[model samples]
Target: ANTVQVQVILDRSVPDRTALDIYSRPESGGDWTHHATAVLVSDGAEPGGARPSWPPRDADALDVDDVYEALTAAGLHYGPAFRGLRAAWRRGNELFAEVALPEDRHDEAGRFGIHPALLDAAVHLPAWAGLAEVPEGRNRLPFAWSGVRLHASGATHLRVHVVLGEAGSLSLQATDPSGTPVVSIDTLSARLVSSEQLKPAGRGVGDALFRVDWQPLELGPVNRESWAVLGDHGLAEALRGTGVSVSHYPDLTTLTGAVQAGEPTPDLIVLPITTHTGTEAGSGSQQAAQDPG
Candidate 1:
């Protein structure tokens, strides 16, 4: 195999952040050959006729490992199986790069599940075209999606292409190793926002209780206090306004009997938050916190 060389080019914008090209060649010539490219990204305008500091002039000798380390430090762990960026450079109005996706991403269905979360992270590859720079400290933020599609379930290799669009949006397309279309993602966008800005869109509460844990409770016990709290919380009012049915359990024994008879339990179970004794205490509480069908 022959050695393959990988090069990274950061555009004129933030010229100093550019990294040197990398090379990888096989010791045996009989195996398949692979090649890749990358680009750097930055926040400022391009420098005119400026040369990159090269040849290890002083204490700082920029190397491929240094750039890769910077990306990893910035929470850029896309997974170790995928190959790193090869050659990177910026175009007139956008940034571009060529990356090699590993052959192991396919699933048994002959298609990649390609979860929305994983696709979103791949969009950041093009950002490296500007230059390698330390990212500002920030917590993980949620990303929004208008639409996404996974064209193929399983693909051994991939070619990733990205473009930054208007309104701080990004577009990405992944192709097979032979340059054939594997997946096309459109109307995609992402942003870095505070955690407080993210919230669940719906609200509901429920719990499940098992028979073993319920066996010790006294029968015919009523939780009037819990009932009052539910009433004050507007749960009863909310139920009354809707067609949903609400049931009251007099004691844990009744709940366990229902379970033994294979009857569906109520969605919500009212239990006092007071402490309990024995192993049932911890186990019962855990069961209560679980989702009930």
Candidate 2:
């Protein structure tokens, strides 16, 4: 989990000339298993690292569906369901594509941060675009990566771009709709294989579509369970660290009194955490504990 190194195989005769095998131990102290293997194609560059060769004379192409199938077949379950591909297109030797974000990826403040899983998924866009190549046949190999960056937050979409450079090197970039770059990869100095000519191990391709819902939490006194849940999940941490406070009122009568008295009640009010809980008037008791000031 700390670091990952992959192996790549290449064959000059095949159209798809790159393949990758990722190896990882089940646990920190557990045995190693061939986690996943994928095929890609490149004109004549190395697999991992930057500064391999340069702009390949020829371009390589690989099926998007095949790569997805290989990933799940290798026991790397993406999630509950795979959304369909968002978009795919080609420009010269370069390829571009997009994929949807998962639904369960929400942050504690009722907002979402860039999930690490999605970060891994974003890196695959370049390979899917045909900017790089994988090897052919049924082989489990490993690939190496250098730097990865998560620049944007609350991203609901992903985009990939790949450019072939001198000496068989490839430059890849991934971003979101706001044009915020998430990751950049330069792989030419590393070892790599091509697998564009091989038939996929399976016929079915995983879906790449997802539906997400964003709900804002009301900022008011909530029940013990709600307060604890929010705190444990991160809301409380954010409030405590930032010196923010939440106030709750028992009913509309008290709320109206405060409003008429020329006091701003609250920007938002969340109902009691429990269904059977009655209106407990004023600041309640938990609010004081949470915000002594």
Candidate number of the best lDDT? 2
For residues 200-272, could you state the per-residue lDDT of candidate 2 as single tens digits? Answer: 3323543222445599988997633222212233444554455445434454455556567875545444333
Off by over 4 Å in 2: 1-67, 70-85, 106-113, 125-135, 138-142, 165-169, 188-293
The positional error of residue 111 in candidate 2, measured at the CA in angstroms, is 10
RMSD of each: 23.1, 25.1
lDDT of 1 by residue, 1-293 (tens): 22434434334555545432333333432222233333333334321222222221222211233444544444444454443444333444344344444434334225445533334435545443322222343223224444345556555444555566754465666655555555555555445533233332112421222233344756796543222112123555565456545544445665566556886655555444544578563533422433233
Model 1: ten consecutive residues of lowest lDDT: 47-56
Report lDDT (CA) for all predictions: 0.43, 0.47
Model 1 segments more than 4 A misplaced: 1-67, 82-84, 103-121, 127-135, 138-142, 193-293
